[model samples]
Target: MSTWLFDLGNTRLKCAPLRDDGSIGEVVAIAHDDAGAWLDALPTGEVACIASVASDARRVELLDALCARFARLHRVRTEAALGPLRIAYAESAHLGVDRFLAMLGLCGAHAALVVGVGTALTVDLLDAAGRHRGGRIAPSPQLMREVLHARAAQLPAAGGEYAEFADDTDHALASGCEGAALALVERSLCAAHDLLGETPSLHLHGGGAETLRARLPAHAWTPEAVLLGLARWHVLRIA
Candidate 1:
């Protein structure tokens, strides 16, 4: 029987087939607002495992669409404890499942600082023992640009190179927004080092990660971290 993994985030829906060896296959990302037309094109499978951070209405719409396409649907949620991972949240439900799963995918022998750059900038720290040490959330550079452009139409929303000191308005906007996000990640790394008494491995993911990853070359980039974690979640459940 075929099984597929779905990661539904605020801006995109990423899906991939589960390979026989339990690894995730190539990922296909779709915009939630325009996903209806593409649903029928997806290969019908025996089971669909989904981890979603989209709104309730959007999730229902997707579930309704996939009802007939898969024999069973496994929707994953944030848990206080899952396998080796122990979430730090007092109310686990408040933590986005994407963040939880991303940590799961990145967690291993060493401590890690997981950074997600998408519609929002999110950072979480996980110790070697799989204990989540909490995290921070801020507006992503793209989102900051969008909000600024929306508030002030004169500022261009997209375009401009990142610079330490930008001469023009467009570059200034880009520099300021991107700089803020970069500073946050750097600060988190410093704090993680101090907290752990050792430099934790940095893991980057999400659509906006490439820009940040470019600046920080040493960090690991796992674009499919969420899906990989979902696969792990499924295996543990069925084991």
Candidate 2:
């Protein structure tokens, strides 16, 4: 039977099929600005699994559409503990399911520092034993630029390149915003090393991940972490 997984974020919706080997097949991404018009083009499947962090109204619209197409729908939620991973959040529900699921996608015996650069930059540290050690969230590079332009008026909200020494305003804005994100990742890596007594494996994902990848040479990039996690959850829940 064909199964589909959808990961809805603040800016994008990524959907894919789950293969027999437990891997995500060709992903299709739809921009939130398009208002899910592309959802109508998706093929109906036997099962649909979703992890959403979009606004309630948007979620309603997406859910309504999916309900019409799929026979079974499973919405993944954040939990205090899953398998060997134990969330440190006092109220586990407060943690975003995307982050929790991403951690689950990378779960293992080794310590890990998972960084997601999407509409927001989110960092979560999972120890060698799969214990959540807390995390941090901050404005993403695109968000920083947007906020600055929203306030300053003159600054452009997009189009710029990152550079060590920018000679123009556009490049300066890009460099500054991207630099801020890079700095946070570096700091988190240092802190994770200190707390874990060794350097943890670094994992990066999301739309902004490519922008930060070159700066983070040692990090592993897993763009489909959330979808993979949802697929895992589907298998476990059904079994």
Candidate 3:
């Protein structure tokens, strides 16, 4: 029997098969509005474990579709504590499942500052002991551009190269927005170091991660981190 992992985010649905050795296999990303178009191509497996941060209606639609394929479905939620991992939120439900799982993916011996850049920029901190140390949320660079273009007709929503000093408006928008995200992450890292008395490693993921990876210091980049976490969660559950 095969197991599949699905990470349903604000704009996209990413799925991957849980490999025999328990690693994530090739991932397939599909937009929310194009779900039906990819249904036939989605792998049919014995179990489908999903972690969703989409709207209620969108989640229902995806679940309804999955019901036709997978015989058993597991909806993963953020728990106050799962195994050694402990969430800092007084109400664990307030933490986004995507962020919870992203941190879960990197749960290990070393402390880490996990950053997710997608529709939103999310930064989370985890100690060596798997304790959540809270996090911050802000608009991702792309989102910042979109919002700016929405409010100001003259500003273009996309297509620009990031630079320290951009001579053009497009590049300036890109530089400013992405620079803001980088600064936030760096500030968080500094704070984490002061609080923990040791600098934590940095981990980056999500669609927008590539945009900022080249600009940041040494870090681990795992695009399918959430899926990896889902796979780990499944294993822990079955074990």
TM-score, per-candidate, Cα-based: 0.96, 0.95, 0.96
Ranking by lDDT: 3, 2, 1
lDDT of 2 by residue, 87-132 (tens): 9999988999999999988989899999998889999999988899
RMSD of 3: 1.3
State which candidate has the highest lDDT. Answer: 3
lDDT score for candidate 2 against the true structure: 0.89
Candidate with the greatest TM-score versus the true structure: 1
Residue 5 lDDT, candidate 3, scale 0-100: 95
Model 2 ranges with Cα > 4 A deviation: 33-36
Q: What is the C-alpha lDDT of each candidate?
A: 0.88, 0.89, 0.90
In model 3, what are the clashing residue pairs, if there are any? Answer: none
Badly placed stretches (over 4 Å) of model 3 are: none
Candidate 2 has its poorest 10 consecutive residues by lDDT at 33-42
Clashing pairs in 2: none
Model 2 has a clash total of: 0
Q: On residues 7-117, what C-alpha lDDT tens digit does candidate 1 reach at each position?
A: 988877899999888898989988766537756556678999989888887788778777889999988988898888999999999999999999887788899999999
Higher-ranked by lDDT: 1 or 3: 3
Q: For candidate 3, lDDT tens digit of each residue in 1-239?
A: 88899999888889999987889988999876743664555668789999999899878887888888899999999988886689899999999999988988888999999999999999999999999999999999999999999999899999889899999999999999999999999999999999999999999999988989988989998888899889889878853
